[model samples]
Target chain A: MNVIVEAGANYVGVIGAGEGATGEQMVQARRVGELLARKGVRVVTGGLGGVMRAACEGAVGAGGVTLGLLPGSDRADGNQFLTVSVPTGLGEMRNALVVRSSEAIIAVGGSWGTLSEIALAVRTGVPVIALGGWPLPGVEVLVAQSPEEAVEAAVRTLAR
Target chain B: MNVIVEAGANYVGVIGAGEGATGEQMVQARRVGELLARKGVRVVTGGLGGVMRAACEGAVGAGGVTLGLLPGSDRADGNQFLTVSVPTGLGEMRNALVVRSSEAIIAVGGSWGTLSEIALAVRTGVPVIALGGWPLPGVEVLVAQSPEEAVEAAVRTLAR
Candidate 1:
């Protein structure tokens, strides 16, 4: 229960397919992370492979803070780009941690795990912008056409 | 990372709506908890009101172990029926903890939070039995007609 409140630090989650992600999706996720990091927003992710690794790489490359909520207990399982990696050991349940830790979420692609994070964020009243994500029938999500649009929407949603 | 491996202890999560749970759902959830407890299985819940409280109450009444993963950092926020309440401080994210901690899941009813847990469990290869829950189109969940059926399914799933 150690609550560390960093003043003026905005954590935005970038959720997407972990394995089997398309190259296009990875490119979009990387750009999204870079944009958010350049804006001084901390990028948070599930802390594994595919989109999560790509986003963290982009953020770290831009000299920005990146937090990874890793699924396993081993910190070595996290990508090299993560500035701070929390080995939650909660398996895929760490997706919920990623959603809870972020002020807003930018969904880069679609997957069952990513869908669960989006569902948790929506249920908990966290604003989410999806870029090339699933077409949730009843879910209320703002669909962004590109990575830049997704980052802009996330920033604007947090401002509100 | 303190991992307490309780040998021979089977933990089953009973998830449902907290605030707007119907009386029927409460009765079913309570029966599910009681049945699981009678079999020497531990009942895990979200540690709040409605179905979570009802299930914990039943399990405690049966002199069984009941664990609650509370959403906030205050242990006092948990219901009195919980034998061990861990204040996760992860908001709705605690649903994932409940899912990860359980060997099987018996969903008494459905909500956005419950759905998130169900999705996480299914994604992580955990068995799920839905009793009076949602009919997810593409989701492969075993449906039970009553609490007894749900508890039986949970036990059988764990045995496998």
Candidate 2:
């Protein structure tokens, strides 16, 4: 089966904790999504809950396009805020799709899953802007103090 | 798009270094694939060179079905030994797919990519049987001294 890669549109992944994300992380992720959408960048996410749901909500609320790469085979498993959802059935492996579909990544919070994505992105030369995540010593992860800063870093890196 | 998860095919992932794998690791990986295929189990891999290619070669030589989930968008990126190849276009992030698609994993050797798969499997409750991989102090990875032992451990775990 052939999977088409969307052309011309800038895609950015917003990755973070799924179920147990803190309230502050959700808020930050939502803001990051909103800002990215306003910039005409497509917001790509894991498409389940917590930060993923919040990011889609914020982007959709702003009348922007959001793509959810779901872990299950059912599209209904995605959050309500997604503009388009694809059930990848890759489970946590879908995390790679999320990272690959984007030119840059803005990590909202820390989780084992998130760490895996970050590691993958770094390994594959995708720039990452961590808003609030665990420190990786000897790894070059761009740190962002706020959502705005994260968005700015991501966009700037994409520009380069 | 709906991805059909092949039913009734017992899949086990053979993961390790891609381009820079050692000769010994390639030999071990091939033996593991041959053994698994002889047991009527399907072998899954990342569909590139090094350990992945050797494993596929052994499986196909043994007349076993081998599936390669490629990192690129083109099926040509897969090795010749693959009976079927799916171009996932997920890049290094496709490591998650490799882990998620398998009932158990037999790591022929270790790399950052291999480590990511192992981490994903451990987090998601998939069993792992490591052959000459790194030490994970807290993770529950079964150790195998040879490819025969590794395949035995993998099939035994799947049985349970």
What is model 1's DockQ versus the real complex? 0.42
**Which segments of model 1 are wrong by more than 4 Å?**
A1-9, A38-40, A59-65, A73-75, A83-93, A135-137, B1-9, B60-65, B73-76, B87-93
Quick one: best DockQ, which candidate?
Answer: 1
Candidate 1 docking category?
acceptable
Which parts of model 2 have CA positions greater than 4 angstroms off? Answer: A1-9, A34-40, A58-65, A71-77, A83-96, A134-140, A143-149, B1-10, B34-41, B57-101, B119-124, B132-149
> What's the true lDDT of residue B65 in model 2?
86
Q: Give the per-residue lDDT of model 2 (tens digit) for A1-160.
A: 5223445668899998888999999999899889998887889999989999888888887767899999899999999998889999877778878888889999998876786787778777889899987665334789999999999989887753
CAPRI verdict on model 2?
A: acceptable
Q: Indicate the worst ten consecutive residues by lDDT in candidate 2 chain B.
A: B1-10
Model no. 2, DockQ = 0.26
Model 2 / residue A3 / CA error / Å: 29
Candidate 1 TM-score over all chains jointly: 0.81
**What is the lDDT for A51 in model 1?**
97
The TM-scores of all predictions, comma-separated, are 0.81, 0.71
